[model samples]
Target: MMLLLMLIADLLILSVHGWIVYKTTKIECFPNARYIRNATCGIKAVNRYRSHTNMESDIVNKLRNVSLNLQIFLRNSANKFKPFLVNVTANLCSILDKRNFPAYTTIVMNILKEVSNVNHSCPFTHPLSTHQQKRLIVKNLYMDEKFMPIVPPLGLYKIDFNFLEGYPYDDVGTVILYIQVTDVKEFKLRTKAPKFVYSTIIYKTLSIECKYNPEILTNVTCQLKPINWQKSVCIWDADIPHSLKNISIHLQLFKIYGANNFLPFLINTTLNMCDVLSKRSFSVYGKILFTILKETSNINHQCPHEEHLSLYNLYVDARLVPVTLPLGIYKAVVRFLEGYPQVFIGTTVLNLEAMEKRERRGKVNKN
Candidate 1:
């Protein structure tokens, strides 16, 4: 502003001097007289007379160049503000054996990075399962590699016990869930996600038959727990009948799962087995067929059976019947032995599991 004012003052001074020069001499020399508008001087002499040397038009051009430079600088700064990038993967782990360790603690991040930082997070266990199971807190996790930031972010790190195992084993066998980790933000259908789930039991409980008196039929409720990995599918016995009521009530148990596979064979085998079963004369020859029920599941191989496989003998010491296979609610049952204590009635689990298998497959969307 001060320079502008000075330039104005200087222009005024130059105009007055030019006016004086013209008025005092040049106009006097030529008397027909032009006005101030008409008065003129040499261009170089006029410009030199009006301006300070330092505040020349060259300076204005330099100021314009500075403005252009500032604009370019601002544009480059805006480019840096685009977007920050981070990559995330999924986590799902279920353990059958505590001693067995996971394969990978972290997955290999495949995403490429350029301008910004890429964050690949370690697998985090889900809060619900941990709380539900009240199991061990997952340990030995890492940040970069030894959890150090120095390790490269692109590669995979050892999880020591990654739960995305291809081989699945269900502990209690209700449901197994597997979680599939993914690098992208959107979930993929094709990607095999992680889940821990119970594979449907292809078979359950083994069966054998024992026959006893219907009047003395007794069952002792015993917990069928697997000891040392041994399995007890089912047991069938149609020895002697007490009252028809005892056979019906006692035989009610012994259920089976997925009946489509083994029920027919069991029924066929039990019927044939009973036909040949020699009965002690005077004791009603009878048999009751049943399928066992043991859904309290785990990852183990138990053969399928239609029902308790049983044998029936009549005309024996009636008192010994209670002592021999003494029954209140034994795991095994004797359903039909004709001419025995109770008249033989017929029921079989030939198709008990067929409907169940179809329903479960539909539920899982196995197709």
Candidate 2:
């Protein structure tokens, strides 16, 4: 009887271990805000999402205070995120003075070491620049897989970092961060194919509008016309009297949320058009533009333009776009600048919509 019970206990332990090994968790953290009251110092904080998430905070200490107080609080979705689960407060300057830290202080020190340049013992006299703060914060704030503990229950978590100063410990500022934990099993079940498969995207141009400075570009004409039920073309013609020695292009993509309300979408970039034309360097969006314009325009040539330029029946190929973009109404603004001081010479605005190929076909048939 004893041997049989022992075998059953071993089987139960193996089952639990297998379950933990198979299950995986994903954690995403994003900055919520940084609020500071009336103070002599200045703080600038920004959160951006591009191909990846980035958070930056710049602190300008004009007062040159040596001591600082840091308070951390963690809240979860158990009580609808109303109450705090853990509250930790410590004197940062005092902690820096200690050679050996207690168990609770170790986690706080570890986090500061990973995210900032406060490795050495304090008195911290040197001023930290905005560039240095941005580099350190954005580069090192991500959580590593090895450092992640066992998967907690899937929910939303909020962490608040409150900073205080002076003898009375007045509030200086607060930086809020939100964390979301999700299970990989649900994600796998929802996505049938890979996330960025090119064949899945089907974008269509709805309209195009062009504006140019009459002094810079003369005899300008731009229009968009439908070739067939499935194809459209954009035609552009312009004349330039003086040679453009240097030029830059700024491209921004906005997703239309509601009537007359536009929110910035994935793509926003400014690059040297001359460098791209000469093939010196190209970004992902630049590559897309180059691929589309190479077949129909004179944009592939190097800089120094003094004559007429024309793009006859230039087709906007949807295949060149990033497949990760969702189906929605989108607007793209392209601005052209010239010379060293960067004078805005022209702008092109395109209103577009993305839909699945089958949905587009169905709409055409219904029309």
TM-score of each: 0.16, 0.49
List runs of model 2 lying over 4 Å from the truth: 1-199, 359-367
Best by TM-score: 2
lDDT of 1 by residue, 1-367 (tens): 1111111112212111111111001001010111011211111223311211111110111010000000000011333311111111112222111222222112212110111011212122233434322111111111111211111112111111111212242111010111111133232333354532212222222323334443444441222222222223332243223322222222222223254221101011112222222221111112211111112211012222222334222112222221111111122233443333535444322111111112322355657
Best by lDDT: 2
Write one digit per residue (lDDT tens) for candidate 2, span 188-307: 444454432233445667788999988889999999888765567788989998888798888777877758676755445677877877788645555666776688887668888778
Q: Please report the TM-score between candidate 1 and the true structure.
A: 0.16
User: Could you tell me how far off, in angstroms, the CA of residue 247 lies in candidate 2 after the best superposition?
Assistant: 1.2
**Model 2 per-residue lDDT at 297:** 85
RMSD value for candidate 1: 40.4
- Candidate 1 global lDDT: 0.20
